[model samples]
Target: MTAPETVVPTGKSGIYMPRRSLLMRIADMRAWLFLVVLIAFFEVWSRSAYGVSFILNTYNLQSISVFATAPLLLALGQTFVIISAGIDLSLGFVMGLASVIAAHVANYAALQLGLPPLAAMLVGMLTGIAMTIIPGLVNGWLIAHLKVPPFIGTLGMYGVARGAAYLFAGGMTISVSNSWYSTIGNGRVLGIPVLVILVAIACLIMHYLLSQTRFGQHTYAMGASQAAARRAGINVKKLTMKIYLLSGIMAGVAGVLYTGRFSAGAAQAGEPLLLDSIAAVVIGGASLFGGSGTILGTVAGALVIAVIQYGLVFINVEPFWQFIAVGTVIIISVLVDQTQRRFTGGRQVE
Candidate 1:
């Protein structure tokens, strides 16, 4: 084999390379840097405002993890939808609906059918999954077959699902007496909260699905250009349906967690999670315009939001002010995303 000749820049480029390289790397890492800086700022502020112990407290960190699990799961599912250039406004309500259905089913199985706790729990979970999947399928059909816009399709489902939740529970809470169901959310594994463990497992699975599968590749392709993806032999309709289905399934999982944690399924559960999940996804560097995101980034984003919320509460900030702070962060995140898109000629960052 012939030896390759060395090639070198011959002009001003050579002088510029070393200096520009560092700047380019920093620019590429802006999202991660922003998250780190935000966390550091919160830690410092918490120490100053409350006490060093507040910032260093293991209990507070654990509490943040607990609070973060629901939103984290919702955001993970939102990542899939948004990556495919779709949105799911109904997810929060779907979670509530699923929770109610699960709780009611579990209660009936345990009390009426005289089933064992584990068996009743399993039955409830399956029912919840199926309930959420129905909306997912309907949303998919509306968007893919009926040609409804994703936003309109999901928005309509939002109302439908929420209404169903209220109706199912008679605008009240459905309590489940099964201790085994509660264990799913409250029990610990090796000193870690089971809810946190579920979140970790979900992140790992989503990371694998998004980073290593042909489905993931198709998702990016579809988001980038649906027509082009179809031309390239991707099953755009089926893929769209599957994406929404997965989102619904995740919402169902969140419902199960909610029911387990509270020992009751309230019709209003997951209402706040809608915006929080979107904020997490956006803060994590996913463009609303779609086609780019990562599960790891989303997890970091959730932590950032959780830290801000926890820090605010620790410093005794009013809840309204905390909401404002979160809103501001979300706006800044969107601006940053837009700036990045502009700089990159509208191409999504991988």
Candidate 2:
């Protein structure tokens, strides 16, 4: 390897800085690059194989964005947990629980209690979001207070949540009759999906929380090193609780949005999204071992998955390939993360 030669200035020769190679500089943006590459590949494939433009179609773009919303929302919260060196497997079912609960509550409020449709929908949304706190607290207590491993604690909660969701739904889907609710779920604003617009707003808020606040700073500190963060006067336990709680809320939000989009709440609403959520976080450049990730990267990762899913169908690929494709990306991400860590001598880099 050749290092850049130092160039001394005509008047000042004391200062010379090493310039980073192009690869190193763009390492953080790998997710975006992957997304671009996938889009280009799919566009070419569609043109040649199907005699149509894949990415240029309005319907295809909208469908991809909508497909991404659920996973992206789930991944947003997962981003925080993973950044703190933890995971929350329960979030997927926590979303299911919220969905079922939201649909039931909305029905009762509107039909039984004689509340207005719009108000009932709002009530249901709030209650559904609030219901996730129970599981969040449980996972937090186990991991933060009892010293249980995050994976185990969250996995346990995952079963509990799954069971509860099915129980609430009575082993079936609950459809909402309210027209207002349906509109919220399926409606578009200025040619954009309401769900997509809502998720975009959520992404902005999460980005602020993760990148601009003291809490975010503390989260990074904890993920990088719990003991070191504690020694530096950061409260690791409280932060852990907050992280899981935030994660639960993220899942809950996704669930409510699910209800709106589908006009029905299924106990398994988020069952298949677990892998996609994790994949988005990983492909977005977050290390599985923790301590690094970004909201923007996660957005790109989710878009990459969505495009692959939608594009594959557009070009006549089997549905099962989506899983394989996403898993491959995840493996590559981990390998890249490990290599980057090695290059950095084990220091966490953003």
lDDT of 2 by residue, 1-350 (tens): 98878755644766655555577557778899889999999999989887988888989988999999999999999999998999999989999999999999999999899999999999999999999999998899999999999999999999999999999999999999888888888888998988889999999999999999988888888888888999998888988999999999999999988998899988899999988899999999987767899999999999999998998888889989988998888888777877767665667554
User: Each prediction's TM-score against the native?
Assistant: 0.90, 0.93
Error of 1 at 90 (Å): 0.5
Model 2 residue 323 lDDT score:
82
Cα RMSD of all models vs. native, in order, equals 4.5, 5.2
Candidate 2 ranges beyond 4 A from true positions? 1-19, 348-350
lDDT of 1 at 230: 99
lDDT of 1 by residue, 1-350 (tens): 98777557666555543233464445445556666776677777777766776546777877889888988889998998998888999999999998999999999999999999999999998898788989999999899999999999999999999999999999899988888999986888887888999889999999999889999899989988899999999999999999999999999999988999999997788899988888888888777777888787788778778877887787677757768877887787777667656665657554
State the TM-score for model 1: 0.90
Error of 2 at 307 (Å): 0.8
